[model samples]
Target: MRRGTGHLMNTSVTVWRVVLADDGGGGQTEAWAPQGEQPARLSQPTARQREVGDQENAHLTHVVYLRPGVDVRRGDQLRQPGLRLEVVAVFEPSVRGTYLRADCTSRQAEGE
Candidate 1:
């Protein structure tokens, strides 16, 4: 998540939903969605140099669109209206004009 200087000045924050896989053997792999308001403060960022695109973008939202630990496929759900997206390809923004997409298989979301 990138924010402009102004947004940072205003104490910008967001929520991240990461999937944790279960290793079997009485273990569980559940996705974690932080409840309530949590401030996201990065002490040392992997990305140092900031650019114009570093500014706040609409794609990153305060809430997780796909939800946590939900078995989502390539043609899963979409958040934005008129926003055609897919999970088929994972894109790295640093790679220039590369667009990311994904395709969900028959995998069921853990704890779904």
Candidate 2:
């Protein structure tokens, strides 16, 4: 997607990575560390269902657009207000490299 494609990216997302932290018991705990923030255009969420084992899993997927050359990787997460999106894949959707697309999955928050 181009920068001037009439899509106003007013929302900013903070990128986070899971890191191992010492728990003082010789074990490590998975914690989220903020990598950085970036301007992103969030597409409308799409819902789908997939069969896993013997149960069906429902999840939402969103396409996030960011500037070209952004170092986004799989397993990273994008955090916005009241939303957390786990990055499933990252690729350049356009041939001109104007922006990068991050395919993310959103599930219901715990205890919801």
Candidate 3:
């Protein structure tokens, strides 16, 4: 893999991490803090459908590819223009430090 091969990654996305901040009243507030932005490619969306009780629910799983050394982790989020994807897992698909692949799920479909 080569760095120049990332030309297909045209989507600009913001990476965010969840932080717990003290609320000053023996509680904490969960907030999303922006980590940074990166050029990424989102693809391979698969529909996951299941039945809970008498209702059927569906969610989408997508693969996100980022440049090497992009500090993305599980539980982080990637936000695009009209989409919010929660990172479920991260891995180096090529194992050559060329890029990072994140398996993400749609936050809206998860009812989050």
Candidate 4:
């Protein structure tokens, strides 16, 4: 994969970061805060890929590709309409400037 291929990212997704905010009762509460939205390519992994994830205990359901240096991280949530995916891991190509890949698990959205 080469850099500057904008067409590869056909879909958009909002990135949510998990923040621990202080609760009024002197406790910290976890909240999802929207970082921003960006173009991405999302796809369901094949059986072989799924099996690899399963063996690694990642339970990956989807793979998201974004521009290299995107701020996505493990535990971040990628949302689009009725879908919400929890990122299990983030991978960068050793060659650099290729693309960022996030292995995610699909979770049920509240409205769906």
For residues 6-112, what per-residue lDDT tens digits would candidate 2 score against the true structure? Answer: 25666789999998999999999999899999989998544332222113222436778887777789899998878888887788864756678787778455776
Better of 2 and 4 by TM-score: 4
Candidate with top TM-score is 4
What C-alpha RMSD separates each model from the true structure? 13.8, 4.7, 5.3, 1.9
TM-score per model over all chains: 0.21, 0.70, 0.74, 0.89
The sequence of per-residue lDDT tens digits that candidate 4 reaches over residues 1-112 is 3447467999999999989999999999999999999899999998998999999998888999998889999989999988899999999878777889999999897756
Model 1 off-target regions past 4 Å?
Answer: 1-8, 26-28, 33-112
User: Which ten contiguous residues of candidate 3 have the minimum total lDDT?
Assistant: 49-58
Task: For candidate 1, give the lDDT of residue 89.
Answer: 21
Q: What are the per-residue Cα lDDT tens digits for candidate 1 across 10-111?
A: 222222244567777878776644333322222211232122114532122121122123333433332222222223322224443222222211223435
Stronger candidate by lDDT (2 vs 4): 4
Displacement of residue 72 (Cα, Å) in model 3 is 0.6
Model 3 C-alpha lDDT versus the unseen true structure? 0.77
Per-residue lDDT tens digits of candidate 3, residues 1-112? 3355378787878999999999999999999999999999988654331122113222336788898789999889899866889887787865566788887777863454
User: Number of clashing pairs, model 2?
Assistant: 0
- Candidate ranking under lDDT, highest first, comes to 4, 3, 2, 1
Residue 84 C-alpha lDDT in model 3: 88
Answer with 1 or 2, whichever has the higher TM-score: 2
lDDT of 3 at 77: 89
